[model samples]
Target: MRPAILAILIGLLAAVAPVAGGATQRASVSVVADLIERAAPGDEIRVPPGVYEGNLVISKPIVLDGNGAAVFDGLGKATVIEVIADGVTIRGCTIRGSGEDVTGEPSAIRVTAANATIDSNTIEDALFGIDLQEAPNAVIRNNTITSKDLDAGRRGDGIRLWWSHGCTVEGNTIRGSRDMVFWYSEDLRITRNTVADSRYGLHFMYSHNTVLEGNDLYDNSVGIYLMYSNGITLRGNRMRNNRGASGYGIGLKDCDDITITGNALLANRVGVYLDNSPSSIGSTGLFESNMIAFNEVGLLATPNTHDNVFTRNAFIENEQPAATHGRGRLVSNTFARDGAGNYWSDYAGFDLDGDGFGDVAYEPRSLFGAMLANEPNLRLFVHSPAQQAIEFTARALPELRPEPTLVDSSPLALPPTIELAIVDSGIGGARMGVLAVALLSAAFGLVAAMGSDRRLTAQHTGGGA
Candidate 1:
């Protein structure tokens, strides 16, 4: 009886199946949406190497595999793939946008499930390359994300995480996005990514216990921004060329217990800008074993920031040197060519002994630096001949220089664990010197203009006639 029933059901299916143009089989589905609609949990959908134009929604726990370099084009309206189920894998595809949207968040791919992997894809032209919301234990790795619009207020990010935890974001190249990594989520590992031409390379707000390592953050308005975050480790990163009028390589505000080590900060308007407002009380941050070089100012610590340590770090050739805003301690750090001194290109202290370290203490903080702190425009006089003469005199006379806290008579030892001197030697120092010269030239131009105006007025008056 059961065999007869199965045979009757098969006969009914065959009779109902539609055929076209003398064919017996039904027409195969052409759109990816149709394929996804037909997919079941634990099934696999193999996409061919062609442009599939539509929004794809994966509601079942299935694998979507691109067989041969497939491309998913989102026709400039909606997300390419929106995953709403756990244990989904989307791999080996090129996903392109659905252009920018002012009213909503558009993404090339969005994963809102657990144990999902989005990998080895090229995503572009979306408001966000990948948006991970409320997804835990997800891996978004080895993707290239690019966007054309990088305007300050309009452009979107490469990867945006909201309320997601235990995610690993690794080995991605994110370019032309406003904020490459926007982390409101926590417990993330962001490693070995190259983020450039963005507004803020890595932005962490209200996120904690995140690790960012071995990343190259360059050409952004601000390389890394940490706000109200804690227990974050930023290690072995290179932040350079982040030069806008108000840009910083790294900006920390109201953050605590953050460790920054083994990073190179080069040619930024401000290498690290720390603001401790009244709201930020008892914030303890540590900056250790980083090469802060060739910046307009090595470290700008504002008022209300307290109990932070600048230890064992190299501050080299900064035009205005270090500016202290609030009370902070600088301990056992190298400031000059001598032992424990930074490799300041402006160091004039003599090495009286045969030892490599200078005999006299090299005071990195200067009255000129303090003056420039009050009047930042006076930074134009940083490398002026007159300024050089003053610095020389200050170095020759101990009282002339900023009073030394103490001198390290012994030879300076490089930090054993941290490779702070990773940058090419000539490039960093030369860049700082060039900036100093340019600033001086501007100052001289202003002086000449004032003098010319005064002489013209005197000539017109003709001795009070």
Candidate 2:
């Protein structure tokens, strides 16, 4: 009877071997978990090539190198990998299948430990790509991240640093996600990252003393927005084609001691929008050597924005070079410092003395610009004859001429020499094609409508005659 029972158990094990050895590979999955349990701290675990089911928690310091062939799939449940141990390194792996429930805040990789290096990982189909909560001194580099196939607003952030300080996020490409945000995370060195096709490319709140250099942010709603963040240095960044509602290439609200230099703000709705920035009295903001070009409004500021210095920058070919949000004067902001002012493409003044500086000051005092400042809907008439008539009437009647929005006392005769190296993500394939078709269709329709309106006006005038 005992031999009969043993024979029955062996037959059951043989029958299940085919299932375990096939697609599920449950034995390899258990082997990894068992090995992790048996390994000591600081062990270098090189996971073999396989699609292992992941709900992994690395609570001890170790180097988990996947060699780029190991894929950890979470089966669309909670976080795939959670690192609670400091000094753990997770790299060279593909991590996916995080739960899509936003309420649970599911993520592919959640690191709550300090000094973790999450590098060169391909993370996709995850709600939140990589979330670092209270994880200081983390190095998140060279990771390609994308969120789940939810709406842009519903998709979680591609990379979020919540109260994580002294972190370096470099050389990462993030797309189709909500934002790459830093909340209360300070002392960050965020450089050389490309973020596109999402909401805010980079959003910072209460994060101070950060240096953002060589970042490319485009095709999004707002390129970079800093709220209540102070002592930030934005240098050598390219912001382009961000034309959503409130599409500012760089926006600063209630921020202080901000330095914006050597950056490119191109083809946005507004190049830069400032609302009470340098909010603290006696605080200073600096804008110099930057190229602000081809935007609807180059610089849009609120009534109370004050004490910002602008020098040696180029403002080129914007519809309105500078304007106020509501009723206010821009005399509070200094357009010239140290005998140098910005270069204005629309400056009608001459360099009579060959000094490379305009003899007359560049003051934007257009009547239509003032009207658009108070009532923004007038922008629909941009580039139309109606806009030209309004400006002509203002020139004919001096009383209609509004005060200058801001004056560049010593405007440069030539555009300032500033170069920004923008990274091409090569991911704007079908979306750009569709956008081009829509823009061409709208332009042709506008031309046809304008021609019909002119013909009708002429016929009505002839009938009255």
Candidate 3:
């Protein structure tokens, strides 16, 4: 008779389970620290599904519902699920091994208090997967944090928000994990995160009024490393590639009021690396309409990084669309603001007032790009023939022009259609027939010295703001 109705429903769930001091609220994996030391204070601790191991210190307001097949294993020795108190959550568990002991800083889910949540968990082979010390109004959402521990110097940050504040780190996916940091946090709201590989896929120090939108930083080594921050707002992010040894699609050091707009900075290696960063003043910082393509130096600003605002940005096919560090000055920074500028795929300049901007002032920088911005190994003789005879002696000796580091004045004979996504950058369809016959014999000797000095009376027409 159906085995006596399955032994009368397993003797009515062992006669109402609850035992407290004796521990038994229907959870398993060997009593899970005696059912969270006899859970109470807003208890819900379901956690059934399997492998529980050790180190679980939940203080109180519990929830820990591992409905997604639990597996909390702290074997690397501690911090598998710390959670001090205040409204804890730790949902859909699978949190794994932590404890690399960088000062006992092990973690899989630490959360030291405040409105905690840490949802959709899957945190893998960790060192520090979701550690939000000094935890404030937390919400580390849609977590997946990983780190098959490939020695990223010593894995310890897939999500670390020390001295945390009003947090909301959303839709996480972080890989490898050396940093997803936001030290000393404040009004945070990081969105749609996806950070990849390791070493900094978002590392803001002294975190300030943040608002990073639609994040997707990839192949990390530096895909967003703002230091000494200020009211930041990097919009519609997508920093990609991120090659190393100083790779960057966002490295602002002494940051202040940053506001990079409509971003895409692809195949990064120095797309937006400012030293003293957009230190705000009047207009309050800006790097509008970005897509500084195929980097090798698209906007390596440094010369005092004065009052920021590099308007309508889109210096495509960058082998150097402007650079500066030392002796590479004169970017008195302000590449056209209202009359509009910025869109230099090596602007040829000739907008005789047809108004899509490009009426002269286009100097886009290059004494061999100021020696690859002060000796970046002169890039293996860029286009040899002695670098096209030093670019035809800096365009027929305009006093060997190499000063105006970024004065676009209205430059853009094409390239700023703005709604940025550009990253094909075949880099001028490749060529090297001896540097294409030394740039076609330096463009027929610069067209026979501009046809004996007539110089074609200014006339550009590729308009398309």
Candidate 4:
């Protein structure tokens, strides 16, 4: 009897397959495209509440408003929407079901024209969320994007700008995607964005004069990576728990004229990693007033990385506050600027003159750190007995002490206040609220236990009565 039932169900599913396939084919007709053709170039087309299946192309200036209740389904085909005209606005739509093939670089929306606005859209199950190619002065804001259900390495970028200069990307949340990348783009203003569960929250290459401010990035391979970019300003961003393979809160390579200030780099493998930055001769980098805290290595720089000034930053409770990438020391980098230096939690120096600066210079000369620099594998034994023994031996014997990696002549006597406001994506708030509730419950339980004990004592010794 069970075999007969299974056979009947299989036959029914087989019979429905062709009918379902025909429905999908019929839904592939571009309904929005017909509406676009009928409307004038400058007219506003407000799509009503429904699922409009098929791909769309906007080739003239117009406002395509979905009224917050419309969805544009791609039928698992190529890009869902393509904008080829300047001054186009696409907002308040749900875009999903793009083709999963990475070879075609399928995106929910691909804009190739200048001054387009893509805002307040939810893009899901897309291989690539939004791609702006040579689309200068574009605005991308308040969008939530999640990629296809592929492995992290196979997923395409959440948002990508290729040669799209003078763009503004703000208030977007991206998750489970490859990267939010900018390539060969200049004068970009990226702010207030939250990106997590991605490869790189922000990746920039050859993009100059960009400002990345007030963004929150966590649980990514790397928070932000800038390569071959110049005149980039990174300020007031919170990068936390980015502990992937190359887990740097901020990684810089061959970049020049970079300013990193007032940011919090917390709980990453390396808070900041630098490789030959200030690559151009006579160009300098500045890192100031930032919080580098609770990482395996607070700052890790290659031996040849030079001309970077670190000042007014706070390095707090890292396993290794600073370390070289390889065998050499970080003597080329400046730890102090204009008689002011950063705050190190491990600094033993004191300020006798009440000047808020340490009297002695702060130098990190750890033999274990030097060994870890030469052989990064040695970090496996970090915080173990072996590491303690090595550090103790170096401290006991002056000759065994390695040269200081970097010196701060005027180390701060106290940690400076760093002001940063990151937009939380509610996960942090929920976790914190749970912790508060747990704490309160524990306290209440303890109080009840104590009261019960008091009552029992009163029955036995009359003290509580």
Candidate 5:
């Protein structure tokens, strides 16, 4: 609870002002919803360490400061905390035990209020962790939310923002839920969070002008997926090992003006899946400086995909570096910008002049591979002698060349080096410094303890008096 409160305090100082209107009519509540019901609007309710039974509602513009000591248990029948008023603040509490009824869609905290803040709370065993419906500019930060271990269909989103425009969701670790869903939410800034073992770490539908950065999304069905969204920027994120049924580090469908840069996508089925992305010829999607490695397919695009550009990204050790479905070649997408292309691990082209560009065009897929891409059924016989012979024949015969999946006119023979800078500003830098110092101190203490143990062992073993 102390650790949880500390996390909240770090986020709170920036989001919320110092508790104003000092102690005018502060009330204390224990296991009673009536206290909150009876409190006046804009009043402060101090909840001490105890289990508060039944459902609670914040109908007035007020502060429910639990300080990580109070636990609101729903007793398995209702949504635990419901905020119905504007400017409601629910902070530093453990809220759990939401109803599992499919119709109810119960959540640990459900907010219908604008400008509400839910911070520094540990929420567990909930159907939905925090459901915000039309709650514009709501800030959810520094909360740890875990949902019930149920099927993806039954498990609701850890935090759902429906029509919650201009909201800021940051520094919350979420797991065991359907997804962190943003439906029709725009201008959102989601950062510094970790999500694992979920359906989709982040799911966006009709969400635009969203910025997602410094987030770790792993072991999910898909790390991040967007459908029919535009103006999305994903940076400084790590997405790894999400080899689920539809495993993709990031899946884009008809998305436009996407800027996915400075991100790492590792060990997923498809590092990035682009389906009709950059929707129109006029729209553009830029993939820049991303590390896409150790995945089944580094970049999988539909045959008709166009208006998408990939530049300065590294494709390493993927089963298929770049692939297209129903394809001879991807005619529309550009692999290189200004004669500088991505670094492909399998590119054997030479850079003789040391200009960092391959003299020959680096093509990731051969003619046979392109055929297999269009006709995926041929993949089953990939290692068979017949398939190998056909591939060799295609290589031997210049006339039988398959269309290039990715044609990099100037691919980098050597891997392009990109230095990812960690944010060292405000609380982030302070936190990193504290962590480094703590780690060094711990290492020194361990060394001293080992030395002492060795001396004691020598004395006990009769090697020394």
Candidate 6:
């Protein structure tokens, strides 16, 4: 009887243990705004897969997780999510349609506090996708943002951060916006993003210690606009196809201690435009190891901008001059051909010796280039015979040409080449030798056939064979 009683007690205890252990602290609420309002700090709000069409304001630290693919539509009027608290994590939600307004500040998500993580979200059809004001130490990662309103008066931006510092914007795709500006921000890292079809892809105003890397910027009015910013580094970016009335791939205005390297600037109106303000003087910049090709102007260093270095760069196949306004150090650059100078398609000088450097120092600037600089419409005569005649006469008489500025003595090395011998016994060379022998045999057969035909005609006519 005692053994049976002990067995019954053990079975009852096993059955009751699960009920006690499975009792968890759960506060599952389904209402959209009410659930967020009633949730306390450290609470988790699991939003189911549904449409929540209202403005969300989180004032406490919590985790807002979309259980499935949830969406929050702002209906083109107000901001979608406004965060006033720190340490809030919003992830995996679709926020859309915070369109432009003449009266209100329309942004999909706006964060005011710090230590926020906004990741893996889709924001679209908004005046501004994500607007952060005074928010520091935020990680905005893997967000797809697109704003369709890009007219002159619409005033939309994909990601506009004002006075926000220590932000990391990584792996975001921004499109169809205008003037995506970051003003008074510091220690910002924008990397691995695709920004296009906007007025300005990444515009920094009075921002310091910013690093932009591995970004693809194209089809914008300005790829990267820097105004009154300092200590910026732009590396491994590709800027192309920024062609319009007033378009530039990269425009630097009144910025200092900027280092731009390993960038590809292709087919823009002005590849890199260095503008100098009245208050800006003795500001130094470095452009190194960049491929500035097929642009109207590769480097346009306007007057009053001094002490810039363009070193180890490839300026290839520019329509006009390689560089405008000669005030910088151009060192070890490739000019024309596979030589030490740049690979200028219009180089008429000769490389007399076997050394790769050209004999004559190729002056990339010309009088016509300067004339077109003053009157950009004159560039329409680039292919005209009149321009060709001027170029020919200028080559013949150096006195009529513009004064040449020597930038660099040695440029980067050319691409590697492969040589093949026609008569070698190797497979590649033997194949060429076989083709040559076949051609020669066919020629010899044609000659023999003509001689035999003449001999047969003479023999038939009783002439000596």
Q: Rate the local accuracy (lDDT) of all candidates.
A: 0.73, 0.90, 0.78, 0.92, 0.85, 0.74
Candidate 6 lDDT over 373-394, as tens digits, reads 5777887888688987876787
lDDT score for residue 221 of model 3: 85
What local lDDT score does residue 450 receive in model 4, on the 0 to 100 scale? 76
lDDT of 3 by residue, 321-391 (tens): 66777665646677878878778776877777677777788875466777666786878987468977887
**Residue lDDT tens for model 4, 1-465:** 999999999888767754664322223326678778888988998876667778888998999998777788998999999999999999899999999987889999999999999999999999999999999999999999999989888999999999999999999999999999999999999999999999999999899999999999999999999999999999899999999989999999999999999999999999999999989999999999999999999999988889999999999999999988888878788999999999999999899999999999999899999887778788789879999999899999999999998999999999999878864545657888999999999999888877787767767787555
Task: Indicate whether candidate 1 or candidate 5 has the larger lDDT.
Answer: 5
Top candidate on lDDT is: 4
TM-score of each: 0.74, 0.85, 0.37, 0.87, 0.81, 0.76
Error of 6 at 380 (Å): 2.4
Residue 114's lDDT in candidate 3: 91
lDDT of 2 by residue, 1-465 (tens): 999999999788767754665332332345566767888888989987767885888888888888887888888999999999999999898899999988879999999999999999999999999999999999999999999888888999999999999999999999999899999999999999988988899999999999999999899899999999999999999999888777999999999999999999999999999999999999999999999999998999998889999999999999889988888878899999988999999899999998889999998889998888678898889899999999999989999999888888999999988977765547767988999999999999888877687878988999999
The sequence of per-residue lDDT tens digits that candidate 5 reaches over residues 326-415 is 654675789899777889998877888988888999875466576776677877875478876886788789788765676888787777
Q: Looking at model 1, how many pairs of residues clash?
A: 8
- The deviation in Å at residue 284 for candidate 6 is 1.9
Report the C-alpha displacement of residue 231, candidate 3, in angstroms.
5.3
Q: Kindly give the number of clashing pairs for every candidate.
A: 8, 0, 1, 0, 2, 12
- Range of the 10 consecutive residues with the lowest summed lDDT in candidate 4: 20-29
Report RMSD (Å) for each prediction in the order shown: 13.9, 9.6, 20.0, 5.8, 10.6, 14.4
- For model 1, residues 214-242, the per-residue Cα lDDT tens digits are 88888888888888888888999888989
Between candidates 2 and 4, the TM-score winner: 4
Candidate closest to the true structure, highest TM-score:
4
Estimate the overall C-alpha local distance difference test score of candidate 5. Answer: 0.85
